[model samples]
Target: MREITGKQITDAIKKLVIEANYKLDDALIKKFKESIEKEKSETGKRILEQIIENAEIAKDGVYPLCQDTGASVIFAYVGEEIVFKENGNGESILVSAINKGVSESYVEGYLRKSIVRDPFDRVNTKNNTPAMIVTEIVTGDKMKLVYMTKGGGCENMSLLKVLAPAAGLEGVKQFVVDTVENAHANPCPPVFVGVGVGGDFEKCAYLAKKALMRGINEKNPNPFYAEMEEDLLERINKTGVGPQGFGGTITAIAVHVEAFPCHIASLPVAVNIDCHSHRHKEIIL
Candidate 1:
């Protein structure tokens, strides 16, 4: 087994958190550029241009792409063949590393501290950590870490439901499209919609969040889901919610769907909305 040091993980997460907050993903940038061209509304086109310009400026580190630096949402895939060495303090090395990175990155980057210490208390965490961390064991020798700055606006607009098995495909499609239409511009316009279908309630929600990690330019690997994604994208854009919701042709940039096997009677569907920033970064170690 390859031994991974806690310090190494800490440093890596810190780097990724800061960089992702400042620089928008290249794939997402490309989508914005393309969206600008396809946008029929003059106002929408102008908004798209400003978005591109903001990305360019943020890339230089002068400021983050959005005022909301976001919560540190981490997805760590620990390979079966790898072992994370414990830190000296006896805490879980992985958790320590992640939180340390999150804390340092937020302070150093001057990003906003948006996380509260408790739901009821409503006190600021001050450091923007500890992260909302998720881990999965996967077949591989390399540890892959995906860091996403999930903005509150878009995250708050996410939706889910446990549909009857009979609801099936049409139900899911209509639900997703309706969610976007209802959201209007709350989550920001030209959003990427991640849909999770078929899994149990919680699993479906996780799948929906994870689906946002996929590149906007890529489609679902399964032909059925791929078609569904395309259909949803078209239908959502047809809403004319436009850029920043002022009204235009390209409301949503893309739709991504991830599916899992479910029990016969249950069909759980989730929609995780991501704003135009699409702040996510990945690294393998």
Candidate 2:
């Protein structure tokens, strides 16, 4: 078995968190440029241009792309052949290390602290600790980490609905389009829409959030879902929400759909919206 040290995980997570906030993903930048060309409205085109400029400036690491630094969300695929070494703490070494890394990155990198200790109490965490971590075991010896900085505005606008199986494909399509239409400007226009179809209630939401990690230019591997993604993108842009919801032809940069099997009785669909600065990073170690 391969043993991975706690420090290695901590250092890697710290680096990823700092970089993800400071640098916009290249795929997203390309989408912005493409969106600019597709945008017919003069105002929308200008907004897209400004977004590209902002990304350029943020690349220097002087300022983050968005004021909301976001909560650190990680999807870790750990190999069954690997084992994480204990950190001498009684708690789960992996979890503790990840949280330590996240807290340090937020504090040392000077990113805004947005996570709160409690939903009702509303006190700031100050260091953005306790990252939302999901771990899955796979076959390889290495670990693959997909890190995302999930901002509140778009996350708050995400929705899930349990449709009767009879609602079928048309229902799923309408639900996704309606969610984007109802979201309007709240999630910020020129958004990336991640749609999760099938799966149970919570699983569907998780799938929707996970869907956001796919590169903006990448399509679902399954042709069926990929075609649905394309259709959703077309339908959403036709809404004319435009850049920042100012009104234009390029409302959504891309629509990604992830699906899983579910019981025959229910079809759970989730729409997770992400603003123009859809910040995510991935690394294998």
Candidate 3:
């Protein structure tokens, strides 16, 4: 069995937090450039150009792309064969590491500390502690970590609906298109649409969020789903919501879907939207 220290995890998490917020992923940048070229509406093209410039400024200035640095969400895949040693305190080593990472990154990166400790009192944590962690045990020996800084605007726009089994593919398509159209400029246009279908309600939400981590230009492997993605994008852009909802042709950059089996009577669907500044990173150790 492989033994991994908590400090290593903490260090890696800190690095990922800094890097992800500062650097725009190449795939996302490339998609923005392509969108600029293909955008027919002059207003849409101008907005796309500004998006590209914003990314460049964030990278050069080593600043966050958006003011809402977002709550730190960490997804960990720990191998069953690996053992994690707990520190002297009873606190979970994993949780401690994540907190350490969040604290260091928020300070060093100059990210806004948006997390509040009490909903009633609205007390600020000051350092952005208590990261939202989701852990899974797998068969492999290596640990994989994905850091997702999910902003409130797009996250609040997420929606879920339980459709009758008979609703099938057509229902799913309508729901997705309708959700985007209703969102309008709220979620920040030129958004990435993440659709999760067929799972239980909660599972569907998880899958939808996971879909946001996929590379921007990468097509879904399943041809049927890929076609659905294409169709959904076409319909969403037809709304003319354009960049930042200023009115244009490029409403969304990509539509990514993840699916799973569900009960015979139910078809649960979830839609998670990521804004133009979609930010996430993965690390394997």
* Highest lDDT against the true fold, candidate: 1
The local distance difference test score of each candidate is 0.91, 0.90, 0.87
Those runs of model 1 whose alpha carbons end farther than 4 Å from true positions after fitting are none
lDDT comparison, 1 vs 2, better candidate: 1
User: Over 4 Å off in model 2, which ranges?
Assistant: none
Off by over 4 Å in 3: none
- Ten contiguous residues minimizing lDDT sum, candidate 2: 86-95
RMSD of each: 0.9, 0.9, 1.3
Ranking by lDDT: 1, 2, 3
Encode model 1's per-residue lDDT on 158-188: one tens digit a residue.
9999999898799989999999899999999
Q: Candidates' TM-scores?
A: 0.98, 0.98, 0.96
Candidates 1 and 3 compared by lDDT, better number: 1
